[model samples]
Target: MGRMYGWVAAGLLAGVAQPALAQEADAPSKDSGDIVVTARFRNENLQDVPIAVSVVNGDVAASRNLNTLQDLSTVIPTVDFRNGQSNKDRTVFIRGVGTITTSPGVESSVSTVIDGVVLVRPGQATLDLLDLDHLEVLRGPQGTLFGKNASAGVINLVTKAPSKVQTETLEAGYYEGGEGRIKASVSGPITSTIGYALSGLYASYKGNVFNAGTGHKVNGYDRWGLRGKIVARPNDDVTITFAGDYLYNRDNTPQGVYVSSSRIAYPTGVVTPNATLAGLLAQEGITPSANNKRVNTNFDSEVRDRNYGGSITLDWRLGGGYTLTSITAYREWKNHQTPDWDTRAILATGFPQGRDDGTVDFDQFSQEIRLASPQGGLVDYVVGAYLLAADTYERYQRSVTQLIGGAPVTNNGVANYGISAQNHALFGEANLHATDALTFIAGGRLIHDSLSYFHQRVSDTATGVSGIRPSFASSGKTDRVDYSARAGVQYKLASNANTYFTFSRGYKGPAYNVFFNMQAFDTQPLAPETSTSYEIGLKGSLFGGRVSGGIAAYVTNYDGYQANFADTYLGAIVTRLINAGKVQTKGIEADLNARPTDRLTLNFAVARTDARIKHFNCPAATTCTSIDNQPLPFAPDWKLSGGAAWKLPITDGLAIELQTDASYKSRTQYAITQTPDTIQPAYGIWNASIALIGDEHWELRALVKNILDQHYANTLAYGTTAGVVRYVPRDNDRYVGLNARIRY
Candidate 1:
């Protein structure tokens, strides 16, 4: 992102050089233009909200420290994540569309939603970093208003509430490799209508940025979090709020050791791990040879996660403008992984192994109610109701042993499972007018899904007579109901010029964790994939509101698709999810945010996509002639991003903030005759940050990410392994320092 558009064009050119060097000649204006967002739920004014949303705040996500959610797409230009040797992986795409599956029973095509609940798995999407109040990147295919898994779009995380008067904050920081962090918050008023708030955070890191030569010790990452809130407005119209959060992390992710290999060839492409097969540990007594040399010397691994959630919100104001809203939520999450798959056999001998332990558990429940109508007659309204329930199960086993010289003959691996789902929904939206430059918009959603999967496994030494068994409740259980709708039209040549057309009927609800994988003594269940989308757009503002832009075009149709393979059932080598057949997609997108003066401001976005498979028959397209048409694994058919920020306030708590960003995308192949192990090449990187607020009660910031350490790769193979050796980390260097405000 061209170092984030050169730090926002050097803080709007030092705030246009402090009033053109007139030495602040007449202060008083922080209008701070643009930055009004609600991501369609009515709050309009995001240049009129036709769609394609993106808003950032919470002080630019905490002065760019960005904490979690894997750094939110290097400044939000569609988003990205997929890293080395698997760190619980993730895949997200918008505009070009996307779906991710790694077989813990698949599920996730974007739909993170926090503050309105709905965080459907991926270990609840890496939490922590609170005290926020903005983050909405809406985009496309919200399945008629965000239905089951969203089909590639929706990430609304809004926080920051619980202040009735008394407020406080405190923060500390240090960074430049060996990291550190601290945070605190407070809010008051426990009477006269009630209120309360509390927050806490702590972060730690070592995550060694690589100096590689293969070794024996490398520390990992660590984190911690806590949040709480409560509010009540008793009388005058009714309002209530409650919230809770907790996070725990232990990342120690080291995985960097793959010095040599060859059976099919690792020849320096590296995938290391065969510490002489633990030298058969004394030929199998159990433990010898100095406790089996710490189990193959630290091949890089450490993961542990614990997340928590809670939410409640209500606001009622009945009269004239009409309003009523309610939200309820629940969540529980867990993750624990032990990695170190052997780095050149623990660096040729010194050893390191915490053993291969893995586990996961996530639970969720949600409820929503809504109603709002108001805005000068010709009609404007919104209504909603939704209910969702989730029960989750996940676990994988590992106890790789051979150790002849150290001792433990044979014990391979396999243990996996998942089942539970229940859902319901009702929704509506309207905006109509007959004349005066036309206007009409409509929306709908009515969906219900009920599912329960049965069958569990413990694999008794690869089917050599296991003890526990029960398969898919005798193969009977499945239910689905789907509906979607949307219509749009707008025409106006003044009032900031307008032109819009839309047709949406998106619905996705196969979500039994993305298709099937059989083997719970027989598996069957993988169906549900649907879509319909078409759009048109134009919105303009020139010279006056200081030039703004928009342009859109789209088409999508997907009948069904779900394929994942790497078979070896009775012999154990997991990963299977099938049912692949139809698909169609098309696209064009555009964006601009100009500010020709007032000391410069510019922003841009562009995209072009073409997806294929008019009919797929799998197993190498089976006579479908594999027209794979390439460029869709990590979809990047062409994209661009722009940025600029400049400001200066030498007086009044001294201010200096400059920013930047630039981007490009093209090569990203995963098949279709482009093999060189299915491509991924094309890179760009740049970044910067600086801040000093010191007394709105103290605030200081500094950040530099990638800066230009470019090594590009953020998505590729996951489970069904044919060997890709994972590498999607484009952050080679980063430095951070922050401190924040308002009474300690």
Candidate 2:
């Protein structure tokens, strides 16, 4: 392992925020606009349930100017997400556990589902964020509901269902940050029992933000997306839906842009990369458009990207207080990109040759069928089946040039890697009411997984390395049988207070990366990583429901750790995977929502977690010792955030609203080996939005991220070429102006 995970006192401030203040039990809360989510896989009161859940509805997304899942974390506490190097690259860690890669061969620890269909690859899931009904974020373990691949939790995107009501919305926005975006959607009933919706998105950036002055070239970004959906209700007892989307963006983007931590304490170049670094210079010649680094520095790039996907669902009523539903979906996404990172790093220092034109293709299909009941009863049962298959291929060309007898000699290199995974499973959950205040949930799953890996690499006469055409073929098939049991005793201690204790178990399948990549080195197979947990919590609307909140504490143990890392010696890079020793994470979490008046609402969340190696005997097999005694990489022990939304009565049919969010994270090491290059320092950020929402159909919004004008990194990586590591900075300051529509 190259890094150690860290931990914190997770639930120290659990009772911080209050739930929504809209005081009604039968209808949805007005505090959270339309598009309420069924993220918990059940329809229940968001404030009443005991799960750790956060929701982002339609209006909230548009008003906040959130374009990708990475941007959503700014407003939602307990969520840490990012897309680095490539738009296809994304990592989402909830409760401090997740993977960092867009490579299909690597799977993310956290589970993601869209409209009940599992998203096999992160790249396919990175498609544009369009007209969605709502996004449900469930923190902690979701092993019971999500099955394999859900060691952490689940993030569900529930699209807007076909509605009988007709609606139309169009949006146009521009930013001082050299960015422009527009989106439009329309929906109406095709028949008494059928409905459909279609949408489009277009966004572009002029590539001028980095301010580096290099011909003002590599900083711009451009993209477009489309979405289509259909719903059919043949009878009162059955409903069906079909949907899909596509998005493409080109980026000649730059990365690794930094500034002086303190204007007076240091000079920019003294702390950041030198001018015309090899990595940056190489990017200039290829795709200099979507330079995220340039977007952060002098801001310039010439790059582009495209993403797309679709789905279909059928729900049927089977009478006898029972209902059955089936959801089938397919997704296809591809990206053609170019980068000059190495060139930028070696620009003037003689390492000068680096160029790569890369492309990735990802396609997936999934189907799930489940049944449940909405009636409150003493005993009930729910069962379902899920199947998923995905195929991904990535290919790239990189080259270096040199002076041969004063003439340039070019060397070209190519690498190809892919992953294909298919899963079939059946799961069941049975719930029993032991008492009026006690409900128990027990579930199990039987799954069969087929995992395959394909890899090949070639180096032309230019780069010095020969092509054995290193390639391996594996159709590894493994069957996984797992179960999750939850027993909870919810007791009414007081008139409005309910407290409960629960026990559960969950796991992430043993991925094939450990074997496939090892095959590249002609090695053997490693083991799988798994976890089990126990939790205790108390929740209920206190103070006559005026202030609602919950606090929970949990302990979890992890076994069979899998790690893939890189080692460089003599200027050459080597990569491998190893199954390490055991580790554990224990923590506490809490959140609150309070409304003091008709126009003011406040919310806050705080988490403290402790994640570390219980025993790591990697390089040495004899005696057991800790792996650097450092906290896990990317896992922060302390995180806290609060927000207040206030609506003012400015005039008739019009209201002025303001929202503010602030967050802080204690610093921690990003990788196993502790060096200046990979350690991430602690930092905080604030964002605010002011908007005018009107009656009938109009909205005007203005927002400023990094309200304090703080320069910081939301996501980062170290050691691009060994020893020389730098932090990648985001465009810390961005302000947007937006106009929107509605239909009554």
Candidate 3:
């Protein structure tokens, strides 16, 4: 950690001589020009905000073919996400901080907010990000203003809104291997005081992997989405906006490519395959393959997801130089998945050798009201109140089947769980300008959170199995009050150059471990996790708004740290959350842009993170061991990314553009208690694109992804008996595509 900071200090000192210039202009900004963001709850120049945030424009996403969380993580430093037992369930991590449990009782430390509305579950973050105006990545604790669950950070998505001008855009593209996609959007004025916009998208791709066992293609993808928006301005002082959207995704389950081991552990430390496993494999006509990309499963594996939502926002100006804003939103998400947990056609020990089902149904509602004094005052203030209500239902089913005396025996078991939660918060912030160049900010939030949970299991087996838990029923309720606060001071040395330091405390309410191993549900409530973060940085514009960026360093300390432990029960893999004691995370981040010439632009960003458990003692439940000083899982030590864009004019109405970007990550750990087998080697990826623009609102583009064709696993894990198993569910290979667009 000391050596990592040494380089960061030297780099900052080297750039100290560069002259910094003023506030960013409001002209149309692209790749590296005067980036603007809403990280501070208002539209402000990125370089002026005293926070560490990365803003990516919609044009950049369109040119780079970035449509998924994995793709977005590549360009942003200190961000990563992985699939859970079900691919639809995504777990996002920032700065080595995130949740590993996908159970209904657990919530993610990282928050995903779209247009000021926060999502309730990690699965909701997997929805397709479309028609986005910009994406903002805020690092460090943000609970003081956003919410209590934003203990790690926040990802904000802002979509394009209705426009007054009449316009339409159409685009189509084809990738290698017969995949096709199309997008359309139209917006215009409907009346003197109203405007409307409509947009839709559809895409499909043939799977790359073939299932020899079932003689069907595996891992195919199908997606569709639609959005409608309306904006009304009845008077000069009142404005209202209504937005609604629906997205559907259906894809084959990305089962772990089997490597080895399929047996339940016994008390005597003996392992053996299922009694009738060999016969069942033969009956299913499955031939074992050594290739990792091949699928050899007997059961059907797929995931179907539906996400829809709507929000209405009202902004009104009142008497006495004040403005009022109100927001109301409701959303629902449902996912059904059948995953081949065993990854093989053969059965293990129990009656149902391979797992069959998992489901999650979630609904959420939110409202926020805010009143603020107009700008241009020595002391400015904003006060707000927020409320959220959510409900979730989860179910899991197991197919209990075995071959007895050459005859097939079958039974079924089901587990059902429910959780309901409500949260109320009052938050306010005020800015005090002491001098012309010095300003102070302070904010705080008071939140009351409550939730109820219930779980039930049903089965006919009278005798309990050695490794599996029997049917049981349990219910519990928990409630708590959490508080978060923030304080910061900014000093401006010149019109454009400024440096600031901030201290913030964030809180996350207690969560349950709903995925019971039958080892008891920890009737006692789990302790809530809390973090104190300190950050200092320098940011400013330069070269007349053509070049702008920032450098920041932050350190965070955690109490009652939460982490995961993976274990096997009844020949099936399961994960459990534990209070892993105190942990500390320290990191340095730097970003810069240079537009030496009007036609060429370059940008660079780098981050180094060191997250480790400071203290942890073994628990009394099992033979668990202490993991002191161990680095957190999925936290990379170093990440570097950069890009360059160059444009050339051909004629008065035509132009050509070339853009390229690349990223490299250092060795990362997949298990908190790291082992030689759990470490992922360092890897890099590159993307390049070329485009041509015409005078009549027409454009053509060509893009290549993973130019080196790296065959690295997105998520890698290794076990004693299982050599290696990875969740390489999608896009592990290189891709080439061409797209064309027309606008009127």
Between candidates 2 and 3, the one scoring higher on lDDT is 3
lDDT of each: 0.58, 0.60, 0.73
Q: What is the lDDT of residue 2 in candidate 2?
A: 12
Candidate topping lDDT: 3
Tens digit of lDDT per residue, candidate 2, span 615-705?
6645322232245444665677887766667889788899987766666677755554333344456656566667788974777778776
For residues 1-744, could you state the per-residue lDDT of candidate 3 as single tens digits?
Answer: 443344344334323211111112244355346667778676677777788987776545764666766667877877877754454456888998988776677678898898888887878877567777778889998887785488899988888877668999998888876677888999989998999999898988777666666877666778999988899999988989999999998887556553332332322334454335444444554332223566567765788888999999998989677889898999999888887655566654443444668788899999989888776578877789999999988888765565557666655667798788898999988788888789898989998989888888775554533223677778788999988888999888788788999998988888777753334644445678899999999998777767677899999998987667766554445556777788888999988777778777777788899988888745445565566887888789998777676779999999987777767678887776565445567776666678898985998989887666655666665421233455553456778999888999
Scored by Cα lDDT, where does model 3 land?
0.73
TM-score between candidate 2 and the true structure: 0.84
Q: Which consecutive 10 residues in model 1 have the weakest lDDT in total?
A: 18-27
Worst 10 residues of 3 by lDDT: 16-25
Model 3, backbone clash pairs (residues 3+ apart or across chains), number: 3
Off by over 4 Å in 3: 1-32, 85-88, 259-291, 319-321, 348-352, 402-411, 462-468, 516-519, 617-619, 718-723
Which parts of model 2 are misplaced by more than 4 Å?
Answer: 1-37, 207-214, 217-220, 258-305, 343-352, 401-410, 461-489, 492-496, 514-519, 522-525, 572-575, 617-628, 722-731, 734-744
lDDT of 1 at 465: 16
Could you give candidate 1's per-residue lDDT for residues 1-744 as a string of tens digits? Answer: 675455345434333111110001011222323335556565556657676666665545555566565665555555554444333545555654555555444456567787777787755665555776667777666755664657656877777777767878887676666677777889888898988888888888665433132442344467778888888889879888889988887775444322111112112333433344334321322132110112123245667788888888888888888888888888887887776443323211222122456677768788888888877789877778888888766665544433345654444344456667777888887879767778898888888877665434443354331111122222335777877777888887687768877777666566443222344423445676666777787877776656566777778776775544333332223444554556666777776666666645666666676766566545431223343443345556665556566666688667775665555556665432223433556554555566666546666667676564555445433212112333324254344454455464
